[model samples]
Target: MDIPRSFRKTLLAHLPYAVNEDFTAADDLAALGLNSMGLVQLLTDLEETFGLELPDELITEETFATAGSLWATVSELVPAGQFSDA
Candidate 1:
């Protein structure tokens, strides 16, 4: 399955240091400049974009470690049939 375009766009907006468009799912977001402050803001952006709230237990360093990991966690929270290629 592909990551939602909204998710990708929102994530990219917060990643100030991201150098290229080829960033992969396993890429480290922090290395791309997603610092602690960015992460906090990202959480809010994600919730508002997806219209869902991530549980407190799900908010952890591991969940935000990589793009793929974060997508996996988000994919689980959002309703099925919501992911699209657009």
Candidate 2:
């Protein structure tokens, strides 16, 4: 599976805001209404879904400021070619 696409879908499913396909990678999640609790939930879901144990340092506002930024972090944690198309 495409990690970024999956992550984006998961995030949108949990978000209280109405994010559409028009949403870009540079869109600020906080500004888009993703509060702390939502962020925590997103993190938890991501960890469970991806079977990842994210380090504390990786959980930062800067790292999750945008979809692309968060995807970058995931890309770093999950090695390339590890994610499957299924």
C-alpha local distance difference test of each model: 0.84, 0.74
Give, for candidate 2, the lowest lDDT window spanning 10 residues. 1-10
TM-scores for candidates 1 onward, in order: 0.89, 0.80
Candidate 1 colliding pairs, count: 0
- Candidate 1: lDDT over CA atoms? 0.84
Stretches of candidate 2 exceeding 4 Å from the true structure: 1-3, 82-86
Q: Which TM-score value belongs to model 1? A: 0.89
The number of the candidate with the highest lDDT is 1
Candidate 1: list runs displaced more than 4 Å. none
Give the alpha carbon lDDT tens digit for every residue of 27-67 in model 2.
77887778888888989988888778789988998988987
Q: By TM-score, how accurate is candidate 2?
A: 0.80
Q: Model 2 RMSD to the real structure?
A: 3.0
